[model samples]
Every structure is written in C-alpha cells, then in structure tokens.
Target: MKGVEIRLQVQYRARVDESIEACHARFTAGMQQFGPPFGWQDLEPPPAPYIKPASGDMIGVEWFRYPIKGLKLQITAQHRHELSIGTDKDTSDDRLSIEFKTSNKALDYRAILREHFPKLIEAYRGYRAWAVFDYYGGRYTDWNWGPWLGREATNPSYQRLCKEPGVDIDGRNNIFTLEPAVFWDNELCRRALGYGPEEVMRRLQGHALSVQPLLDGVYVVFDDDPALTYERFLEINKQFKELLGIA
Candidate 1:
C-alpha cells in the first residue's frame, strides 16, 4: 500500500516547572486516550563524562509508544534548561527557565489526525504550545508557508493560488505542501486556478511546485494527480540521492 510518513514538532512554553508538568500530563493523557497503558522510557544519556560547560543546566529525554487508531505512534519529549538569573541588575531575576520539545512518527492510517489534535492544542494552549504538522507525502509535500508568506516573489503561479478565493493563505491555515509535482490533469489545481485543462497543464508544466528539505529527506508539492504525485516523489528521491552523492 502507498502511504506517507509524517514528523511533527510541538513546542510548549511556560514557567519551567509548568512546562515540564504539562509535557508529562500530555503523555499520560495521550496514552489514556489511546486506551493503552504505555510507559515512557528514558533515552540513553549523552556519552558518559559529558562535562557540563555551565552550572545549573540540565537536559532530560523520554520516549513513549502508543496506539492511535490502530497505528503505532511514537512520541518523544526533550527538556533542556538552565537555572540562572539575568545579568542586568534592573531586570535581573533568578528563575528556572525551560524549553519543552516533542515530536511523533507517522501512524499507519489515511488520516491519523482526528479531533484529538484540536483537543490537544486546546489542552496546552494555556502554556502557549503550538503543534506543527510536517506533511511528508500526498498533495502537500512541497508546500511551504515561509517563503510563500514571506515577501519573496519567486513563483508567480503559486503566488496566484495563494491570492485566489476559497484558498486560505493565512499563516494559521496550517496547510503545507511537500515534494509536489504538476501533471496534465489535476482536478485540485484546476479548481484552485479556475482554469481549463489546457491552461492548467500549461501553468503546471511551466512552473513546477517548490521543493522543501526535511531532516531525513526532501519533498515537493505539485499540481498533479495522486498517481503522478507518487511518481514524482520517486523522481525527486532519485535526484536527491544523486545530489547527496549517495549510491
């Protein structure tokens, strides 16, 4: 079966203690939601004797696996912080500040993200937590909000799509594209552009979707059908390997 793997990054900010507690709470809550009695395991520490460059600084790592809609979801959390006070005497205050980071491996399902994510977001909103969906495959592989939302005028065609009605372009849209390709007949592209088949193909071939690089690999988003999307993914994967000098 053809499928896509996703990697997500969730960051939560709050009083150091509160953030840590919130992370723990999330893990417990997620496990219960999945109806599994999963447990968190500590990741191996950095090579032993890891000398600390500073005092009152620490790091913690933990991993948990749970079932979500019949798919195994692996969630990892990392906490890093320092205990110190600001050097500025006026604004200086001694307090423990921490950063909470979490991520998950994709689950085997058409749509792993049910209403759970919205609930999770709401639960952590008090701590100013934000979840980012790093879509790997599908029609959104190559889409990126950074440059599109930025002031750059690189791809005029894509820019036009952003401006089109019924197409939400706001940062809050949360929609992204991976390594997407344009095919001769993509209904989504046709509808989004309000163009005929010939025009759609012309625009697509004339301007390919943008490419974005992830940690392990790169993806592109295109105005192509699902079958074509998979084909283009293979093509880009080959090109990426060649560029990396990988056999």
Candidate 2:
C-alpha cells in the first residue's frame, strides 16, 4: 500500500450577485488571513511562467497550499485552496474549498475537521447570501450546469445503481440538479446538512423545487429561484443542526 494518498476535502457553495472580478478580490483579501500565526504569505496569481486555467467556471484566481500547523502528530496536512467562479442556471456560483492531503496515519479526520470548522465558518462572513452552510465548495464560479437530462414521471434512482453525471431521472414537479459532494469520497469528511432540494426551497419559499434522491443517500436539490440569502442560510443551518444531527 505504498504511495496510497489520503486527502480530506471540505467545501460549501454560495450564491453571489457580484461578478468574477469582485468575488476574486474578496477572496484575495482573505487569502492573507488564512492559516496560523499570519497566514499565506507571498500569495499572488500564478507566476507568469506556468500560468494556465485550473478548469471549470474560473474567471481568474491564484492557487496556494497552506501548511496546517500545531498538530503534534506525524501526519502532514497540506491545505490546497481554490477560489473559483461559476454559475447556477443564471445565478453566479462561487466556490471555496480547502483540501487537506496527508500520508500520515496518526491523524484523526474528525478531529482535524472539528478543529477547523469554526475558523472556516467565520472566514465566510461577508459572502453568506444564498450561502449553503454545508460543505460543498465555492465562494464563486460560472460553472452553470445541471445534473440531469430529463425528469421522467418516475425517478430511476429508486432502483439500480447510479454513478455518473447528466443522467435522466424522474422530474415530474420535482427539481433535478447535480447531487452535492462533487466527489462522493470528498463528502466522507464533510458535515452533511441532509436537506433535499424540496426541503431547502420549501423552508425558504418563493421558489420552485425538485429533488433527485440518490441511492448513496445524498441528494440534488434544484432551486428554480436562487433567492436564499446568507442570513436565511445561517438560519437554515441552525435548523438543520436542530432537526438532524448534521454537525
């Protein structure tokens, strides 16, 4: 089992009204405040020599890895950062994800998450509107796409195994969108909100909703209207904690 790397990725999605430029600026300002002691120093866009797109809804951004410190263990956590811009149907989608990759066997994943969850939550103060409290990724992005092709009268997920993107499903009066946890394995380290599209939209009305339940127990909630705000999202997260053992 040599060279088998284990990494933990945590993310959350946010709906923003700002353009890519504005969103990047906000991220840049925060970049100087990540990590311990001081945070990422000498942070800047990719040096001119080897610059290329990092893929998906990225208008512009710089990449850096903040070394996790203060852990009195053999494991090393190199936290990779992504400030991306994307789109959700018409709403601007922004993503921020911190991935911790380690080869150390002494580290406990839950302990690492619990230690950083509060800091991560506090870091996302300014851009909370339509901000989903659960870990999904993004504070921005233009990757506007859905996860389904068509909604039949019945959802096939009730039967059979599904493991791909853009599959047709039952959409009758139901909202079909991409299931959260961009990488299913990535969700293993996340604190799930467990709220389906119907439930999320239903809680904060003024929008049509649909849900495509997955056999994996994860779900995709399609919000016909992205009007949920950060305050409302916070409220929802609080309720999620109360109703479900999300945290």
Candidate 3:
C-alpha cells in the first residue's frame, strides 16, 4: 500500500487508541490485520456480517503530522492500492492521513516528532475533521481522481451531493463512496449517457474528478444518505449497466 497521508487539527469527541498498529486490539475476536490509524471508538459497528479492518503496509519516505479528538475513523486499509491518473508519480505513498487528539499542549509533539529526524510533520493548524462512515465497511480505488478532493477537503459540495429533495438527518460531515464494481469514473459522462460533465455537474454540483478518496476509499466509504447521492449513483449506475449490457 502506497499513499500520501494528511493530518489535521480539530476538536472531536472520542477515546484514544495509543498505538497506530491496532493489531493488538480489535472490535471483535478472530479479526486479522490492524490498518486504520484510529480505533473507531465512535462509529457504530457495521451491521450483521461485520467488516474487520484490513491491514497492510504503506511504502513511503516516512513522515508525520497532526490530530483531533472524538472524531471516529472506521476503515480497514485493505484497498491501499490507489492509481495515479494524470501523473505517473501518484505520490499517494508520500501522504499519511490521521486524526488524533491530546490535552498535552505542553508537549510540542510536532517538534519532537521532527527533532527525532524520522521526518517533518506538517502542521494543519485549524484543520476540521469530517465524519467518515459506511454500511458494509469496504475500500476501493475508483474514488480518487487526483486534484479533485473528497468531502474531507475544505468547503465540500455536500448540498449538491448529499442534500437534495431531502437532506440526510445525520449526513453532516458525511460523504459517500462507491465500489468500482458498482460504477466507474467515466460511466456517468456524456460518452456513456449522451451528457457531458456539465450535466452531471449540474445534477451533483460536483465533478467526478473531484471525488477524491483517502486510502483506497476506506476513509470515504459509500454514500449512506439514501435520499441523495446514494440513490442518484444507483440510478445512473442502472443506466450504465444497461449500456454495458450487464444484467
């Protein structure tokens, strides 16, 4: 697994899982691998057939950064494989994204982390963390389109993507991701549906290229809001399946 990691400073409410390697602890027994940066102390466990966290190593130059409190992260980084679209150098490996919190303002952890010489940890001052959730808890790569970031970025277009005829009650700070098998980058485009990005843009208020995901798509997950992006994606996907002659 190779990718860039982004750390931000925010105020979330949750407990901490001291170690990044969650292998020692698990939400359930017999769960293999501990990949996610956080312990997911807040996210409600996935329904029925639970999804255990997927684990793997991310090849990188070695670096570090920031945090927040109470923010829940429930991702099993199995989909650590992300492709570089525009440039052959998809330095996703260079990035390490995580959200943690500490009352120890006395400890200049950032300075200490850098002083040790492992690497420089960027200071994401005033960074706002988002609530990432999923139903089944899986990861995929088709979500990343390079320059276009997901809802995790500042000023995401949630109203157009998440809110619509009716808004999601808990859709705040929520964004959706789709499995590649479910749909792909160009499927909804004019070439596939006789409509261009503009039309899709008008419908979603966001470009497909802008739907960036963090770590294989685990951080983003599927659109939980059934009334908005979820249904829209499925509807468009139905047409795509018909066009592809898929049953």
Candidate 4:
C-alpha cells in the first residue's frame, strides 16, 4: 500500500493591521532558526503586490539539505474569510490568516521538526494547529476544526447532519471535536481543554507517546508518525477522542 503523507500545520487569524511587508519581515526573522530558505517565488500572477525579494512572494520554503528530495517548510497568507459554524447568530469573521506548515517525508523530516517545531510555533503563535496524516484530498480547513473546538460534544456540522428528525448513521457528518492527531499544539489548549499543559500531560499519560510544554502552548505527539493505513488511523483517532471524553 502507498504511504500516507503527514502534514503539520499552524493556523491563526492575522493581525488586523498586519501588512505584507510585515509578513515578509517575520518570515525572514524566523527562517534563521529553521534554516535559510531559497528560491523564492510569487504565488499569484504579475503585479502581485505581496511579492518581495528575499522577503515576500514566497508561498513555499525550502532549506539546503544535502540529499533530502521534498523536505520543505511553507508559510502562506490568506485573505479574510468567514465560515458558517452554525446559525446566522453563530457567524464569526476572521482576519486574514497566516499559516505555517511542514511535512514528514524525507528521512530527516521528523528529526528537524522535533528540534524546530516549538520554535516555529513560538514564531507564529497560532490559535489552532495540528499534525495529521490523512489522504491528500480536500481543503485542510474542511475537516480540521474538530480539535480546535476541543471537547465540544457537537458542532454545527455534526448537529446539522446527525440530529435532524429522521436521520440515521447515513446522515452523520464527519466533523469531530477533540479527535486525536499525531501531533498537536496551540495557544488555546488551556481555554479549550479545561486544563494547563501539565495537567494535559497527566491526562494523556498512557495514551500519549510524548507530551511537551512549549513557551506558548503544549505540544503532544501521539505516535512516531501520523501516517498510517486508513483503518489504523481511525483506530488511533477514535481511541483518543473517547479517552478525552470528546468522541
């Protein structure tokens, strides 16, 4: 069977006053810790205002490693958008988003990430983040809000599909909260999980492969690699969500 690809990502609302130049400066400032990035390129067509040499226009970041084929670090900026979490009363608008992501593929990917993931999180300070191994398919945002919601027993999507009068298992939605991933970290852990980093570590003692407390958030790794067969992935994910009382 083909191996699944793992993705580690951090996502947060951009500062309202943040400028493209600022984003460029932040990337340059943080790159030193991870490694210098080269081969910068603009993501959009000509006259792309976000493009800046040695600073901006870079949607993907690559480091100089002797033999790693696809090892890369990516930082992407998104325009402001809104998602329908529920009813009109539940709507919330977010500022443009700033995301940082990396993948586990190359031989040295995990080693490098283990050493630098915390630094990346500190540099970006994302409110929601995850490290998951799933089939390469639809938008990450479409299926990833569950953990961000922490222990919410039900979300708008879940309620929409599972709670309507005559619906059965066939009508159940895939949205889940507090679902497990290979790795997790974010600034909202305390508020969302009802405990601080240390307590979270205590709670996850047996199930968690490793628990790390970072400067701004708690980092939890559930396994050596997020990638796994679909059945195995679901097994791990289910066990964890249930353990946390969020299944």
Highest-scoring model, TM-score: 4
C-alpha local distance difference test of each model:
0.31, 0.30, 0.26, 0.42
* Count: clashes, candidate 4: 0
Comparison by TM-score, 2 against 3, better one: 2
lDDT (10s digit) by residue, model 1, range 40-150? 233211111121446433544343333323223332332324423222111111111111212222331112223233233332232211122223342233343564575
Error of 1 at 168 (Å): 21
TM-scores, all candidates, are 0.32, 0.33, 0.22, 0.56
Report the lDDT of model 2 for residue 68. Answer: 43
Error of 2 at 188 (Å): 20
lDDT of 2 by residue, 128-239 (tens): 2121222221211112224574423332332331343332221111122222111211122122234443443344333213222222222222221223343453344344
RMSD of 2: 15.1
lDDT of 1: 0.31
Error of 4 at 150 (Å): 30
Residues 66-90, model 4: lDDT tens digits:
2234444445553322222341210
Best candidate (score: lDDT) = 4
Distance (Å) between predicted and true CA of 2, model 1? 3.0
Candidate 2 Cα outliers beyond 4 Å, as residue runs: 1-17, 37-61, 67-92, 105-108, 124-247
